[model samples]
Target: MSHGPFQAQPTTKAALENVAGQLRQVLGLEKVDFFPVVKVLEFGLPSIFENFVFRVKEGPAMGDQHGLTFPDDSEIWLRDDVYEGVTQGKGRDRFTAAHEIGHLLLHSQRFLSRRMGDQPIRTNCDPEWQANCFGGCLLMPAILVKTCKYIDEVMDRFGVSRDAARHRTKQLNLSMQEVF
Candidate 1:
């Protein structure tokens, strides 16, 4: 949901989960539920990859937007408030940072080379949806969530908002009696 437009890149939720897991491994956080998403935005990713930039921009008002990523530019921008909230461990802002990281990892121009055409955009092939899928998997990892006994457990253990944990329940199609 950060970028304006991107070429279709066919992918599945399973694929995005794998990507997020790999990123966690790269960040040495494979076994942890909560890793600092803002720290990754500020240091981890940019340090791991060349020319990748993360900035907290002050001006032009981002309005409702929490953060945005320019995949082609290898840059991620956070509105000042978003950055502040994320550093303070606000669940929503953490997801926003993770979401922007998802966009960077999944939607770089080189990775999605097909130009826009007359084809109808499918959700599975959408850049924004893909990023959401990735971000969800990264924050509320399926393996960990599967072990939780209830919704509040997912929210507490994963350090994500209730909305995010509910979305995960839907995405994973878990039994509502257990996780709904």
Candidate 2:
């Protein structure tokens, strides 16, 4: 289940598990809970390690409307406001957590050599898509995604967002246009 350097294989559930296992090993996330909704962060990678420190505020001065990834520190910032905004229900928070974890495990390496003052806020290689792929697989896995058939059903089963489900289909190399 290892994708060596330079392989173009599509993302799979097993691959996601491999990434999660690697994270567990690398970050020593033993006490951390693995679920869709938990708010947590782990630090690693010497150059980008400092970015794991989260700066959060409760009321009115919240900044960005979306998540932020710090390549220099290999950290990801998720706003509570946006998390609640993306997930409306109480129990469905796991999907969001998984998505952030996806960003950490999948996209962090790609930015290892990047500088802090880079022009583009984020790379256009679809890290979000990659993270979504990881999140979908980690949250639901292939066996579960296969049984649902419909995108909405996949969304419900995975407890992921509509966008996450669509990207998951793409990540799994499924033609969504053909699914309907």
**Per-candidate count of clashing residue pairs (backbone under 3 Å):** 0, 5
Every candidate's lDDT: 0.82, 0.51
lDDT of 1 by residue, 133-168 (tens): 899999988887888778888787877888888899
Who wins the lDDT comparison? 1
Estimated TM-score for each candidate: 0.88, 0.51
Model 2 TM-score is 0.51
Tens digit of per-residue lDDT, candidate 2, span 1-180: 111222122454566657755554455642332333333443243323544554333334446424555443555555676556444643244555566667655654543233335334332334555565566656655544555667777666556667767766766666544244
Off by over 4 Å in 2: 1-17, 20-35, 39-62, 69-76, 85-96, 106-111, 115-129, 173-180
